[model samples]
Target: MKNTIFTITLILVGLIATSCSSDSSDNNLNTAESLQAVTDLALSGTWVISSFIESGTDETDDFTGYVFTFNSDGSLVADNGTMTVSGTWSVTSDDSSDDDDDYDSDDDIDFNIFFAAPPTFEELTEDWDIVSRSASRIELIDISGGNGGTDTLTFEKN
Candidate 1:
């Protein structure tokens, strides 16, 4: 009868909805894994600044031809054809802390760069949030630079 048909239709709709929801969650997991793979491959090579923004101003020209090399041992060397600057570099996942069970790593990755002396690239040394990353490039953002300005840095693998 009509009652049985109505019940069957409702059940079918519920099953379809449940199946779609589960697929989305699986897709999210896959995206996270893909991003992590890209980060691992991108970190060990010579890179150059593709874009640099400080306080809403483009400063990419200042670092033209400068090469930055990153090693697996947390060492970094910046070579500008004339001089070299030594520093350290690292990337931390947002959920790396053991105490934060509710933390989500998909949206909270951070990149750190430290220098011993004055760096040729101003405001480049900071704990920056990874906005986006790929096997050949990484986009970073520092919302707080202690100078009330945002810093954006992008590096492309050479």
Candidate 2:
């Protein structure tokens, strides 16, 4: 009877540990807001795209020489000397979909970006999950629900 009880307890502990473990996809989920109280303030000022990957392709060249300004008032600007694009950006934890919060949307915090003009710049638009962040660098990733493709974006303060 003593051996049986000890085995049962060990099994229970194993189960609890397994359930608590998070996979790679969930590693950075919902970290955007929790790490910083004022996300807008943290993201304010100018940034440049250090790296951008789209569908297994290196597309960072598309944004080369461009400077992005994330305004506190939800405004975004990208100027590459000759051309300038305007858009909006935000950091939010609202993961609700059309079917509401239960629509298989994890509680992942998102660094949302939106640019309307210039086809190349439009591709930067996505609700990217914050993978890592620091005073000078912010890394983001997004697994496309429609295509299952993984895209990554990195920004460095300039």
lDDT to native, each model: 0.74, 0.77
For 97-131, candidate 2 gives per-residue lDDT tens digits of: 43222222324566789999888888899987777
> What tens digits encode model 1's per-residue C-alpha lDDT throughout 1-158?
99999999999999999999999898678657755564575566789999999889998997788898877788888898898888887765555443222222345455778887665553688877666677788877776525667778999998
Task: Tell me the deviation in Å of residue 110 in model 2.
Answer: 0.7
Q: What is the TM-score of each candidate against the true structure?
A: 0.66, 0.69
Scanning candidate 1 in windows of ten residues, the lowest lDDT window is: 97-106
Instruction: Report how far off residue 90 is in candidate 1 (Å).
Output: 0.7
Best by TM-score: 2
Model 1: number of backbone collisions: 0
